[model samples]
Target: MKKITIIASLLALSATTFAQTWSVDKAHARLGYSIKHMTLSDSEGNFKAYDAKITATKPDFSDAKFDISIDVASLNTENDMRDKHLKSADFFDVEKYPTITFKSTSFKKVNGNQYKLVGDLTFHGVTKQVMLNAVYNGTQENPQSKKLVAGFTITGAFKRKDFGFATEAPATMLGEDVNLRASGEFVKE
Candidate 1:
């Protein structure tokens, strides 16, 4: 009976190992996107620094775990003036808040190829629950890096005012609702 129990335990452990997990390979990962400003065309940009970790029970992503960290101080809008404006207290307040982050609170498979990701997003100094229309871009192995990687894209909007961003432009200029797009690529450690 003891031997049988030990065998069962081993099987359970091995089964758990079957769960696929990927670590963020910063060199190959991207954490960025932009939104339309002035109700005109979308302005493009990206975060200079970020990391992520994701785990999937299978490629379908029915069962998964996800988390990401972004250095708020790394916001680079390309233009020196715009980047300075974004880092100010009127925006992200890089001096006060050095980092912004998101961690999955829950996940649900909404459809065959879509998912609802519920997570806490921290910005400025406030934490808010944000839901994302997420997509599983699937998984692959990089022959060069020899690392297993998984990718995802998340889209949502946030109230910059909620995080005390730009006290001056709550209604104009920067706009209150900031569009957010996160694309992450994680590799197996």
Candidate 2:
């Protein structure tokens, strides 16, 4: 019994040692989106405020879990009038839904530096499962900060109407699909 207890304690210690927490380097990250407008051109925008974090036990981050939250009021399309309209009840309804959040359920390795990320996304007061293609851009030491950091890029698309956003807009006025692209560098904490 004494020998068994000793082995169990060592195992627990090893597991704890491998676990790591990574925090987003906000200045090195961005969350942006694009959607077709007027059935002609694509309108692009990005959120100015957001937070993201990752937790992993593997060196390759194959078992990483991600959590992210975006401030809806921080949305900007470079057009003041359009930005205001988007924040109103006609679109995002920022008063009712102040934020959008995502929590990863699975992060599966696909090929070299490629992964499939599945998660639950809560947007516009509705929650739904979403999948995104993730690319592990590798890890390296930041020259200035002298810290270990990991880089990643994630992309996906979902229907705006599915999230109860801009439901009244016609197809000719605004496309149903919203394309998302986010990239960030995370520093081990």
Candidate 3:
């Protein structure tokens, strides 16, 4: 009984040592998206307020979990009038849905730095499954902050209609696909 208790304690300690939490460095991170504008050009925008909660058991982040949130009111495209319109009922409807969130369902490493992340994205009061291609930029000690940091780039595309996002423009004018591209820096907590 004594030997068994000692082994169980050691296993618990090992699990605790491997668990880690990471907080998004919002100053060094960005959550952005791009969509076809008038079917002629790409209109790019980013959210100014957002955060990512990350937890992992391995440094490679193969088994990492992610929970991210973005304030809908923080959407910016460098055009004031258009930005306002985007926040109205015709688009994001920031008044009713102030935030967009994502929670990871699975994270699987594909290659050295490439991974496939499956998650549920909630936006515009609708929740849908999404798959994102993620590339881990690896972890390093910050020279100035002296804290451990990890970087990752995530890219994916989803149909806006799937999330109940509809606009006045026709499909020919405004594309249905919303492409998401973001790079985030996380500080060890």
Candidate 4:
């Protein structure tokens, strides 16, 4: 009877593990980023097209995995002429490299509701691994839309020169670092 009880407990634990997997809707990813402008302000932009595959459960994300991609050509800054210039060879060079991608290498829980996400970021024909310190702003059941909603604020920085974005506009001001800040959300379908 003791041996039978042990087997039963093990089975119960296995069932709990099987129930922990969760899949978020790929269409619900909100991706945006900001870069310093003229060393005085920040210029914000977001890609309107992208995809994500996230597997995570509420409260505990140890088993979670995340993958994200952004279309370089879909970059929009709310100005038509400026947008076209940005898409040219001097900037993103979207014609040569069409997509920017991120594949997670590792993630670790920080303090409350936060995780340090380390991933590879590819842009402008360059691939560099970066870390996104993100805060998990809790998941909620939307009252109006009736879907699981999750939000995150990811703050990080990268040097513009690393990806061949060495614009002399900053050199005129004797500035070298191009800080970046990205924040967004994800929802369950």
What are the per-residue Cα lDDT tens digits for candidate 2 across 1-189?
Answer: 999999999999999899899999989999999999998999999999999999999999999999999999999999999999989999889999999999999999999999999999999999999999999999999999899999999999999988988888898999999999999999999
Top candidate, metric lDDT: 2
Displacement of residue 78 (Cα, Å) in model 3 is 1.0
Best by TM-score: 2
Worst lDDT window (10 residues) for model 1? 167-176
TM-score of each: 0.82, 0.93, 0.92, 0.76
Residue-wise C-alpha lDDT for candidate 4, range 19-126, written one tens digit per residue: 443344445554666666666776777778877656654455654567777898888888889788879887777899899888878778888888898889887888
Give model 3's TM-score versus the native structure.
Answer: 0.92
Ranking by TM-score: 2, 3, 1, 4
TM-score of 1: 0.82
Superposition TM-score, candidate 4 onto the true structure: 0.76
Over the full model, what C-alpha lDDT does candidate 1 score relative to the true structure?
A: 0.76
Supply candidate 4's per-residue lDDT for 182: 49
Better of 1 and 2 by TM-score: 2
The alpha-carbon deviation from the true structure for residue 138 of candidate 3, after best TM-score superposition, in angstroms, is 0.9
Candidate 4: Cα lDDT at 150: 69
Stronger candidate by lDDT (2 vs 4): 2
* Model 4, runs deviating above 4 Å: 1-29, 167-170, 173-182
> For residues 1-189, what per-residue lDDT tens digits would candidate 3 score against the true structure?
999999999999999898999999988899999999888999899999988988999878989999999999999999999999999999999999999999999999998899999999999999999999999998999999999999999999999888888755788878999999989899999
* Residue-pair clash count for candidate 4: 0
Model 1 steric clash pairs: 23-187, 90-166
**Order of all candidates by lDDT, from best down to worst?**
2, 3, 1, 4
RMSD, model 3, all Cα superposed? 2.0
Of the two candidates 2 and 4, the one with more favorable TM-score, higher being better, is: 2
